[model samples]
Target: MSSFAGVSVLDDGMLCPSTMTFVSTSSDCGYHLLVVKGYARTKETPNGQSILSHDFGVGGYRWSIKYYPNGIISDRADVVSLYVHRLDDDDGKHVEAKFSFSFVDEVEWQNPVYIRGMKTCSFSSDASSWGFYKFMKIDALERLMNLDKDDCFTIRCDIMVCNAENDAGGTQVLLPDIHRNLNNLLHNKVGADVTFEVGSDIFSAHRCVLAAQSKVFMAQLFGPMKEGSASLDVIQIKDMEATTFKALLSFIYTDSFPDMKEDEMSQATEEEAVKYEMWRQWLQNLLVAADRYDVQRLKYICEKELCKNMCVSSVASMLVLAEQHHCHRLKEACLKFIQVQSPSCLQTIIASKGWQHIIATYPSVLNELIAKVIASNQQLVLK
Candidate 1:
């Protein structure tokens, strides 16, 4: 009597049978495939929340619900399933079909009459029209197939739903406003304000602050305190000189990316300049600060500038900064500059005691250059 049943025809001489061809009503549901992978955790919670981490790139509609629906299970199963539902329209309009898995080892149900090949509607009126057609003994199958025990019980179904679409663009749905989660971490500190002898080296202090969020803002407050009359108010450092202070504040707020100008080294005494040996120390400090914050793009920008203005004396300072901060790319650039131009400017670096550090840091390149120098000792050496 149902539409799925056969229709009979009576002829004058004999009886004949006819039936409706499967119209694929399932495709209308928009479910392409469903994969259910199961796993056990220590208690109930797990990290990474991934059951099948090894098998990546297999994607479907993924959602993490606390418990299985239908009130069938008591505790969290740690069973995650991906439902590949087709995009379909219901009531002559677009809608998404909801599909879930029923984890069972047996292919057929007895007494209740759940069985493979039986139209799912006939066996269980409560269930959907499509049901299981195959039995995969996952645990037993794992041994037979020689798979890891941890990877055993995974079941997949090629789903057929009505009104499903073919193309589904993948996108990651990021959780909103996650930065607010670290607000307490940035503001909370437990220790007393002990007097610490701060160094003039910006890069050194930048490293300490980067290790903890609480110290970052605190370190910014004390920047001008070392210069006695330069600052008076504890809180007024925020409104200090627009140019130099903004560059310093840039490092505090985002780490690195200080504005470099011609006047950056004008105030330094002649003796201290010789010790640091470069007027570009502030720029070098910015590179270090950028590295601490993992601001890689800013770090590259500073390095590019240093390489563009490469000089024998400046190259040594950059090499030291690169080595101290593990900036391998910058260190390589410094070595290449020395190899290319140091033949003519070799005495400039040697006079400044820069060659010793270069030789110590990059022994192989130093050896090759030294040999080249000896080979042309008559012409190049002016001892």
Candidate 2:
């Protein structure tokens, strides 16, 4: 965070003003208050014109509020003239907004005199302002001013800006692309600094990116207990296979799973079945890896992928994996696949080698599955 210090020229030859220096890094859909103090005592020239406020920012553009106490033209001399004008270098640009201008009563703050309806307008260089020539009668304004003890008045403007244009009829500015370029940089592996050795496999990555993305990575690679390295450093990862490590790195970098042909396992051929089985095994391993690394998004992705491929042959193993990883969604999906979607799937799963291991390892999960089955049998009996 940089402090604003009036005006300064950058090395890039761009003049930066303190007021316009801070652009919000996040989305903002809110209101800005424009309070004009000493409004009743504003200096009015012989031409009956006065500028109350100037150079105020609202929705990334500069604006001013002009006031005429005795009206701008001779024909409208009995009334006040009030107009909100754009002062920014938005030459061909148009700003659309709905605004209200009102005079605040000092004694009864809630009972301020408003300009009736909200005035909606598209401001451009040609049609810059939308205002009322007869904002209020001159005599009424003077009486209101005299009633106040301090002889001071307040005027407030409430503006709700919708959007701004590049030109008068041009395209609107789009939202910031937060992840697009970051994803591209990761995919390209550009300027990679650190390397990880998982088993016999080596993965090149950026340390800053890894540290920024994950707290575990930050602790291991950049914290006080970090392995000191200058550049092209190789750090060994324990208790994880090369493939699982690669998948974890892919998610860390791209915020998505790595590109794999097995992701599209639509065919029913023996070859496709083998590929699908491999994919499911990888997802199961990735789920455990995600939990180990504390990557919630990757864990969710793995859980979803495992759920999609759950069958009689894999349900018991998946149930074991879900219980071990504490993936409630995946565990529930496994239970439903066995007990509800296909009750016969349970018989095959119980006979599998992993079933005895699940019974020994996760007795509570096995009890939950039995409860679901007993509940299903009771429902069948009732029918």
Highest lDDT scorer: 2
Clashing residue pairs in all predictions, respectively, total 17, 0
**Would you estimate the TM-scores of all the predictions?**
0.30, 0.50
Candidate 2 lDDT score relative to the true structure: 0.64
lDDT per residue (tens digit) for residues 175-223 in model 1: 2222222322223422323222223212112323433433434344344
Q: Per-residue lDDT for 87-130 in model 2, tens only?
A: 76446777776555655545453342223323346888788876
Instruction: Give stretches of model 2 more than 4 Å off.
Output: 1-180, 187-191, 224-232, 341-345, 380-383
Best by TM-score: 2
Which parts of model 1 have CA positions greater than 4 angstroms off?
Answer: 1-249, 252-256, 262-279, 292-295, 361-383
RMSD of each: 24.4, 21.8
Cα misplacement distance, residue 260 of candidate 2 (Å): 2.6
